[model samples]
Target: MPETPEIPDIPAQIPALREDPETEGTQDAAGTVSGEDGDRGTAEPEAEHGDAGFDLGEPGFDHSAPVVAESLVPESVRQVAARATLPFQAARADLSFGTAFWYNDLIETGGDHEVIRQYLVTATSRTLFEIGQWTLRGDLTDPEQPVDELVMGGFAKRWKVLEGLGVAVMPTVELHLHAERKGWRWDTQEITDGLAAQADDIAAIGAEPMPAYILGHEADDSGRSAHPDRTQRLLAGEVCRPAPDAPLTWSDPLPTGFDGAPVFAALPLPDEQLKLLCLGVALPGEGGPDAPATVVAFADLRPAIHALAPHRRRHWWQRG
Candidate 1:
């Protein structure tokens, strides 16, 4: 492995900045909030109380905790699902999208979400890309913590499949620290300085219980509104074996707004065991014959993920 470069160092201290009063975390059940950022110069409607990939609105659940044994299915995936599988929302041009913390960063692919995906792939690295236009929006957080996990900033990155078929373009963001440090308030320069940093193929599994599961909130329309929070989700198993160049696919349709959903090939192993290959991000899809979803193949992403220095959930970071 090559030596990783040292970017800017972010201290654990929060600036004298106070969070936006209006964006404060909601009461108990609707735990959500957004940190104030500069105007990214885009006319897109801003996320009132952003999602920031929260823990599926379950009050007592801990995202950092390990996945528990199966629970009975309910209204939505929120009940039967593990906290890690749940994702928040993001959008640009008033276009809605879903993104989650896979490994460490807030990832959303451009393949299905052309607008923001294109912006993310083309956006400059180590700099603020629309620090304000708003990247996430959904009802948000647990009472134990102040703010939910947030993508403080985002940048463009590309990864070539091990087979060399094509490249995967992604707009990945840095999740702000969830601890009670700062209430999610940081200027563009502050975020950029922190970003100073900064897929594919398949799972070689030996057959575990459920190889993988797709979890995300698909909107009722392009408006990306899941009004009540609990909505339908796209669920399926992984293509245990896929062609080197082929994008990962599943039997179930990859519903619209499924971008950036994480897939963990449960070789019944740990998330870090194969940070190189077992991890994958879903390609956004529109119901019918949805494009072949992705395996994101983190082979190359691991390096970039570390280079950029995105925040990792305390449990995943400490253990996985």
Candidate 2:
């Protein structure tokens, strides 16, 4: 019988052959890359027992596919990015960041301490404070964060407005540096009391002292994890931006009755998409002609945000 050619045990040799790139290729006497499955010299035809190339494209094993950053780029980021394209309008010094509307009504018999306290507690709770700090100080900074200079600049401008409105003198605004949370908040006792004392001055401005602002945010930590490859590197420093849903309003020209007296009516915004912020003001029995006793609404929220930081921007951005 003619000599029979031995079929080298490819399965058995796969492990060792795969490790040796030089000797890994199967040859048909003439060495060349071939797509043939059974070509011994053609890179061992991917070695049936194991893949020839890295499993760069084996089912869910593609190591080189373009990674889409869903977490690094959130909807908020898109909003901010859009803003960056627009020229930040040159801010005016006296331009009120907000406007107010008023109707006539006497102060409620007595202030509801419980309601005020509860509102204060709920509005400025420790939880909100902690969350704000985290958002501003956390390692993973938010991209939409307004820069410190921008925050301080905007704040200084707004503080001047409050000063013009006869509210309390500029209150201290501080930026907490740390990143899972970030925002601006303030103490209105001194400021609010100041405004209350100056009822005449406030009436001149056609409004009463309301809570400056209570903005908070909780960073999506899930985005920080599981997508380290696609995280954004924010610079370290304070960033400022207009407070969310800011530039409070009180313009419900028409007042309704809740218990007895006319209740403050919060008119729908021009876009008819906002709530009315009705702050109780102790007005003289003879209401101010220009300033009625009703809620006000406008689109300037920068004041409230600025009140949280004063002349110095409280925007802090940090990266881990």
Candidate 3:
């Protein structure tokens, strides 16, 4: 078998989930990315894993209680959330990268539910943070991922996936370089000139061949481990789209590993069927991805993401 050329390097350093020094005056704490699993149902605990000493989400939201994100997501749109959600993991050794969602609550309930979203949100956990950073190394524009410039360049390298997944955002840049683990909400509807595209775009910019699938993990279906060609990365889920804002579930139930996954939706581009992210599985203080999962709406964290939006565009941008 030929050697895999695009194998991602083992993450050299554990990201500073903690605050950095240069991140002064940047009060905007953007708790970027992570998540567990879902099957449009409840989430169960996997092997016990800590969040690397991180706190739950939101300010004055009562950290003492765990927020069940699943509650925020109405049953009407559980399928949509499941379909757009995907785990970011290495092809080998690695377990999971995390999950992300991109959709709204209209597809299933006929706009009956109260929450209406058109933004993207990722689980703000440590592993998910590393997974996101790995994507940075795969960026087509600047694979080098200048960590220093990454922070200064409006976090552009950090948002390529969200941008590719066809999510909308404000033209504001939320700086959470020092943000420990909290999110901000916004009511503004001014859509940023979107960089809407397919997961293919995300794969295209990778160091090697990658597939940004619409839903579920790649399956040979032949009940085999490796494909005959001996090439193709695979995720850990079935193939199918879920209802808008639904949970990403599997056989039996949704795994807790996806607690911080980002949720996406394709309602915005019905004809094209793009996987745009809307919210996350679980925020820091929100609780775990369990029976009563706590999902953070994209709009909830819009302020932080908006501040980081410039990174979705070009570097040398504003840090508003």
> Candidate 2: lDDT over CA atoms?
0.19
Q: lDDT score of model 3?
A: 0.26
lDDT of 3 at 179: 22
Give the Cα-based TM-score of candidate 2 against the true structure: 0.17
Stretches of model 2 off by over 4 angstroms after superposition? 1-161, 169-320
Q: What are the per-model C-alpha RMSD values against the true structure?
A: 13.7, 30.3, 20.3
What are the per-residue Cα lDDT tens digits for candidate 2 across 1-320? 22211111121112222222432223222112111111112122112323323222321122111222333322322222211110011123221111111111111112211000000111111111101111112221233443321222222222212222222111111111111113322111111111111122223222233322111121222333321121122111111112332322323211111000111111223453422221222111123423332211211112332233212122346222
Candidate 3 structure, TM-score to reference: 0.26
Q: Per-residue CA lDDT of candidate 3, range 1-320, in tens?
A: 32211111111111233323322133222323322210011111110112222121311111111122423323323332233333333233333333333322111111211112233334434232232322211111112222221122222223333332223221111222222222211211111112122233222232221112222222232434321121112222221224434433222223433434443232223343333333223432323333333333334344434343122222355334
lDDT, model 2, position 276: 20
Q: What's the alpha carbon RMSD for model 1?
A: 13.7
Over 1-320, each residue of candidate 1 has an lDDT whose tens digit, in order, gives 32211221222122233243222222222232233321111221111112232222332121112233333222223432333333333323433435443232222222222011111211111122332112322222222333233333222212212223122322222222222223442221111111111121233432222345665555545454433243436465654434444445543555654555544433322543321112455553334344545444455444444344333223445463
TM, every model = 0.43, 0.17, 0.26
Decide which is better by lDDT, 2 or 3.
Answer: 3
